[model samples]
Structures are given as structure tokens and as C-alpha cells.
Target: MNDEARGAFATRGVGLAGFDAPEARGLPPAATGVRVSSASDTVSRRALAHGQEQLRDGPVADACSALLRAAAGLRETDPAAARRALLAAASAAWSAGDHDSYRRVFAVGPCHLCGAGCASTPCARGCPEAAWRDHRIGMSAMAQGDFRRAIAVLEPRLHQVTPRAETDELCDAGSVALLLGRLPLARRLLSLALASARAAGAETAVPGIIAYLACAELREGRHAQARAHAEEGLVLARRLGQRNVAADLSAVRALVVSIAGDLPTVRAQVAEVLAVAQPHGLAQAAFLAEWAQARAELGAGKVERAAARLAPLVQPGARQGHFGLWFLAVPCFVEACVLSDRALDAPEMVDLFAVWADLGADPQAPAQLARCRALLAPADRSEELYRAALAHHERASGPYEHARTHLAFGMWLRRRRRPTEARDQLRAALVGFEHCGAVLWAERAGAELRAAGEVAGTGEAGPLSSLTPQQVRIARGVARGATNKEIAAELSISIRTVEYHLRNVFAQMGVRSRTGLAHLLANVDEDHGRGWELPDRG
Candidate 1:
């Protein structure tokens, strides 16, 4: 075998003779007297090749079963080769979404010809093929939404391999980081992966890497950059005939276009994505496409349609655990449920969001959980929950999410006959959506503004108008005679964040002193019917 193929087989835990030397390399020796004759080796190689060919062609489940059977046949004669075959089988099981089978194969150490006590041996220590075994287990964990475990298993191994191997490891680790909402880490890791793939001449890996980077940028609210990445990834995916990667990129592109209010393009892209993904059983891509469809329906004012589309995704059952992207879908699902008067159907999903939020690793989860709570909150408690959600979004620096909270809060205020406050929020949401290229949300905010009897862009723009949602909160706190520490406490933000926003507020308001800021805000509030209460300086 060539070096690349040898590395690939080795990485799959398929130990070939003369390559993976356990005793010679000072690793734990395999069972004694379990030698494979030359003919047996040839037959084993043929079986491995057939299994790989089947995987490349399709029908991954059948291929996995065949590999497992082959491994069983070789277990007594050649434990090392059997272990390799088992690794491939476990990986195939994972790819086919057979979590049960994968767990069955990987949850314990392989039985070296000495079946007894083999389970007690540490897989990593007793097996030279531990890296591949751990990688397969990590991937299965990721599919099951156990991101913490996936990261733990995969992160440390990124640098302990060839560039080609590092490319694959980086991609996996970066994907987990992205799902965990570690944007900077995800970006850094994916960038390195892309560079490594290029250095290794692994052109086929580039599209997948770029697709992940697009997702990271999308969550960061860099819509333009995300679109750029998605577009390039799509082109490469098509050129390489990688339908799965193409589907992923298409779904991402559809989401971007849907947010941009291009309903026709969104619809077409969704169709294309689903068409490719469903036939291949690409659950992640299908989920993303359905999510984009629901978002498009919501944008077009078809709340019921949106709710119907999301029902299967959010409803309790085995399906929930099947899609790792479900966490990202929670906010949209909650909005749909509430708007369609089906809020009662989502109590369980709300609980799920709460659990994810309690984990507190993903930056977006807390804000999304707060939004779901706000939607489900009683009339007396709704406003507080909305504000809390907005504060969480602000602290996370998620402008897109902050705008979504603003839009929801504005609609609630409008229904409560608080038009001035509603207009303020609506205007902010409009500006935020527009800035982020969320054309559909921008239009929705504009409609809400008109409903509040305010002409878009006609209201007198105050200095505070230019401030971000977070800065405005800080400015209001200062105008109310609250100190920085108090503002931080009230907003659930760091003291440093409060101080930073206060500085921005002062600069934007062109004020040199707190008194000056308070005085100016008072005048602006009165002039613009802001309805903010200015307390005595005391």
C-alpha cells in the first residue's frame, strides 16, 4: 500500500503486517500464537478492500455488518487485524447513525485472543490503534450531542499526526467547538485545517472545512462573510461531486438568502438541499434545510406553516437526539410555536432548552433559552423575561439574536398599547436587522413600526439612537442615577462590560461627565417621547 493508503488504513485501526508493530514499537503485545498465514493475510486484505469499496459506493449499514463479521472471523487467528476491522465497522456504524452498534463495538476494549480480562485493559494503552478507536468514539459522541466528551477525546490528538491526518482531526474538533459556540476557537481550528488540507493536497477536504467556517461566521452574525464562504464551498463541492457537502452548503446558503428576504431563491435552495440530503440520509443537512424553510415561512407571515414545519423537529422522541443541530433550531421553533398559538405543545422543548442553557458552554444557548421562557411566560412576567433574554444576547455579543429579542419585545409592547416604547424597540430592531443583512427581519420590524403609527426614519434620532442595545441599557441606567456596578448587576453583565459601554455611550452622546450625560438623556427622552423616567441625582 502507498503511504497515504497505509496511513488511512492505520488511522481506521486496520493494522497491516510489517506496519503496526506492537511489540517492536514497545506497545503492549497482542495475544501470542495468533499468527495469520500468508493466504489468510491475503483474504483479510481482500475483505478490508471490499468493505471500503462498499462504503465508498453506498449501503453503509450492510458494509458495516460485513466488516464486523469479517473481524469476528479473524479474531482468533489475528487479533490485531481483527481490531482494525472492528474499528472500521464501528466507524461505519457511526456514519450510518447506528449509535447502538457503534457503542456496542467501542464501549469496551477489544478481546485480544485472551478473551478474559481484555475488557479491563485500557483500549488506548493496550492497543496501538487507539487513536483511530478514540476518534470513532468521539465522532459517535458528537452525533449524540455529547460535545464535551467529543472535544475531550479529539482536541489533544490534533497535533499528534501527519498533516493529512491532522486535517481530518482539526475538522472534527473545529466542528465540535462550533457547536459548543466557541466561535474564535472554531475559526482558528478550521482555518488551520483548511491550510493543512491544502498543504497535504487533500482538495476533497477543503469544501467541508470551508462549509464549517461558513457556519461559524453565520452564528457570529457575519452574514456577508458567511455567504462568501458558503458560495465557495458549494462550488468546490459540486466540482468534486460530493453531494453531502454540497447539500450542507446549499442549506447554509438557503438560510442566508432566507434571512435576506429572497424567498424564491430560498425556496429553490431548500428544495435542492432536501433533494440531495434526504436520499443520502444526510440528517444534518435535512434538518438545516427544514429549518431554513421554516424561517422563510415565518418571514413570509405564514406562522402556521412555519409551526407545522418545525413540529417534527421539536416534538419529543428519538428524532430529537438524531439531529445534533437541534439546539440551534430552538429559538426559531419557540417563535413559531408562540406565534401560531401552539405554545402548549412546546413545554417539553422549552425544558430541553433550559437543560442546554444550564450547561452554559454555548454562548447562544442561554439567550435562546431566555427567549423561549419569555414566549412561555405569563403576562405579568413576560416583559422581564424578554429584557433578560435581550441582556443575555448583548453580553454574548450576538447582534442577530439581540435584534430578534428586540423584535419580539417590540411586538409585545405594541399589543400592550405602549407605542412609544414599542417604536423605540422596533426601530432598534430594524437598524440591527438591516446592519446584519437580515432583510426579512428588517421588513418585519418596519411593519411593526408602521403598526405603531410611526413613520420609518421620521422619528427624531437622539444620540442614544446610534448606540447598540447594550450601550442604550447602560445609558438608561446612568440616566437613572445607577452606578456602573449596579448597571452590571442589573444587566447580568461584567463590570468591565458596563464600563466599556458607558465609555461608548459618553463618546456617542458627546458628554464629558455623568451629569452632562443624564441631562442630555433627559432632554432627548422628553423630546422624543421616550417615556424614560429620569430620577433625581441624589
Candidate 2:
């Protein structure tokens, strides 16, 4: 190729040396008919090797560009070598956080490094190049907020990794799992990643893994544990000068504090998170911080403010598509919208949440969807939707959400003039909120209870109070006429377990039949005045 033509290719970030002379379209030949020799090939190979070495040690983007140039130079003369160089370039670009470059290079087609026809066989098992291929695909999917695809790409290869696999592999898999609402699997994988990072002294990996663990724990309703993990991760990230990680950890802390009803602390933490995240282009951190700030506003009874803050986030917008954490914000946004008397805004939010509900495979999605529907549904259907939401929330094992559902249901019941039934749900909400350290919610529940003319702690112990949270849930299910099998399926537990819990619930509530159980639970306050007692099976 002529110097001008080669220079043009280089300007476009393509290496021309690897292009065969015949295939160098739009390029003029050298001034003289110069024949390429083996000596020239050797020089090109040396240059490619040097680029590869730089990829391993130097600045990633520069190394990536150099490697891509080398790959282009060898593309026609040495296809296999060119493929290897391109793969190295893609890897370097990904490592440098240039996902666009990675995708651009991979769009050239499957190479030996990614296996023949790799893009079409994303889920193919046992391919020799599966690990690297899936990792690249998974990371790309995650960056695009296509978490279901990311999980599908990563979960299969997780067990195949040897002990030598990088801690990031585990961290990425765990994070995808958590986003999918596979909480148990996420917890297990994140725990392993944390252990692996600590053992290998991978200090840089520790903070990100810990941040994920904190999120998992938060979803699982282990508030204190979540806070501790977030605090530790935040400290480590700041100490390591990992500004993005610190920003993410700060956002996590904001969520924790918001749930705990410390609005002031939540606001402060969100400010810190946004200060670091927005300037650094940390989209995930900024999204989370804004979500947490909205939650804080909601908890503080600033309904209009919360609704305004959350509206843009839940609506179809630039920020909404980039962050898959929208699932976590939906319930709060739905409530804020309804409470602010802007129920018209709910349809779009509900539609967006419904899309996630369909794709997320999260255990909590059904309950959250039901809750959103309850908020948007007409008065005639709202009660049924609320009941369905509560049942699903209980089955999903999110105590904080379950409590919030109860609070919503209690408020609804109170408005319907069923104060006695309202008090039952309010008391349950109060207990759950207090257990989760959601002080504001607990106080709200307490206030609702008082407004129902039920003196706090003055009535005889309600039969529901003696039951475990699980039993109370089962009792409510039975009251709603859900069979044990149906309850089992919804909760992701065995029918036998549901049956056993129902029996305990029946015994505790002094009811021998489902109908009696339903009646007694519905009019629980009637028995409260009579001091109903369970017959001890023990």
C-alpha cells in the first residue's frame, strides 16, 4: 500500500499492514512495484508481538488501538494471527471500559478465539472458548442493562471455572443473579467471590463484591447486615481511591439509610454519591442515588416532592433504559404517584414495570407488579389486588416490602370504614416495620392503629400476633381462599410446607376449617375482646 493510503487506514483506526495488497481497495501501489518479502513479514510479526506485550502492561486504550492496527496489517496474509490480535484488542478495549470498541471489533464476525459462529450460539455449552466468549457477552449485556441475557450467558459457565478463575467472574455472575432476583444463588456466589478476593489479596475486587453483597442483603431484608457491608465497602473504596466504587457504595448506603427512615442521613449520603458519580459518569451510581433520595422523600411524607423526583426516573427516558435497577424503584414510585393524586402517571410506570416483571425472573416481581396494579386499579378491584400483592410479597421473602404492602392495605381498609380489620393489618405492618428498623413506617402504622380507635398494646393479644410471619401469611392466603397448593407455588415452597404452616395457623387461631379460619381472621377483633386462646398441641 502507498504511504497515503496506509495513513488513511490508520486515521480510521484500522491497521493496513495486515491487509493483502490485492484486497487494499481504494489504495495505490507503492511508487515502484515492490514485492513484500519474508523479512517484511518478520518485521510485522515483531511489531504485533510488541503491541500484544503493551496490551498486557501499558494503558489499555492505546494498547487496544495498537493491537487493532496490527490485526488489520495481518488480516489478509495471516488470518489466524490476525484473529488472535483482534481478540487481544477486544479484550483490551473491554478492560479499558470501552465496550463500544469491543462490540465494534467483535462485529467483524466469529474468530478462533471466540469459536466458530460464536454470536449465534451464545448458549452453546462446553465450547472450548466458552468462558472468554461468555464473559465478553455477559459484560456487554450487563452494560446495556440486558440483565436476563447477561445471566443466561454467565450462569452456565460459573460452575465450569477452575480455582484459577478471576474473582471478577464470580462477582459478575453474582451481580447478575442478584438483579434477576435469584437471591439465594446471588448470596452464595457473592460470598464465594468475597472469600476468593480476600484469599488472593485482590483488594480492588473486594469493594465491588462487597457492594453487591450489601445489595443482596438489603433485598433479603437484612438491613443491619446490608448497612455494615455497605459501610465497609465504602471505606475500602475511598481508601483505594476507587471513585466509582465509592460512589456506588455511597448510593447503597443511601438506600439502607432511607429504608431505615433516616431521611437526613439518606439525603447527605445521596449528595455525596451524586457529587462523585455524576462528575465521573457513573450512571448506575447516579440512578441509585436518585432512587434512594426519592424514597427518603416518600418516607418523610413529602409525597408531591417524592412523586416529582421519581417521575422522570420511572418514565421512558434516557436514564431509565440505562439502569436496570428500576425494579427496585418501581414500588416506591407507584406509591408516590398514587399518593400525590397523579394516578394518571401510573399507567406508563406500570407498563414499564410490567415489562421488567416479565423479563426479570425475579421472585419479587409478581408482588411488586400486583402492588403497582393495586395502586392503579379501580376502587372495586383495588382490595383484591392489594391482597394478591401482600400474598406475593410474603412469599417473596421481602419483609420490608411485605410491611409496606400491609401499610398500604391497612390504609385502604381504614378508608373503607373497616377499622377493625384495618387495625389488624396496621399492627402487622407496625411489627414488620419495627423489625426492619423502618422507624417512619412503624410510626405511620402506629398512627393508623390509633386512628382506628384501637389502643396500642391494650387489646387482648390477637391470634395472628402469636403466629410466625409465615403462619400469618398462610392464614391470610387461606382467608383469601387460596389453596395450600396455590400458596406453595406462589411462595416457591413445597405444598407440604404450606400445609404444615396452615395447620399451625389453624391451631393458633382456634379454627379447624378453612372457612372458620377465614371468618375468624376477618373479624379478628371480635375474638380480641374475648381473649381467644389456642389449644396446645404440645
TM-score of each: 0.67, 0.65
**Reference-based TM-score, model 1:** 0.67
Sum up the clashes in candidate 2: 3
CA deviation > 4 Å runs, candidate 2: 1-108, 113-115, 122-127, 134-153, 159-166, 318-321, 457-538
Model 1 misplaced stretches (Cα beyond 4 Å): 1-97, 102-106, 110-165, 318-323, 453-538
Model 1 C-alpha lDDT versus the unseen true structure: 0.65
lDDT of each: 0.65, 0.64
Tens digits of per-residue lDDT for model 1, 1-538: 1444333222222111000011101112233555667777667667866665454334556657777766765766666667667755654554454545555564544534333234323254656555545655554454344556756765565435344546766665566566455677777777888899989899876886888788777777777888998999989888887666677788888877777766678879989987865565555566777888888777655566777888776554566413334556667878777766678877666766665565444677787788788888898998999888888887785677788888888888876889899899988999999988888678668766765767444333668657655566578778878777655533334689788888887887899889998899889888878743212222
Looking at model 1, report the run of 10 residues with the lowest lDDT sum.
15-24
Q: Taking the tens digit of each residue's C-alpha lDDT, what string does model 2 give over 400-472?
A: 8888888888877876789889889989999999998898777667756765666544233567667654465
Error of 1 at 234 (Å): 2.1
Best by lDDT: 1
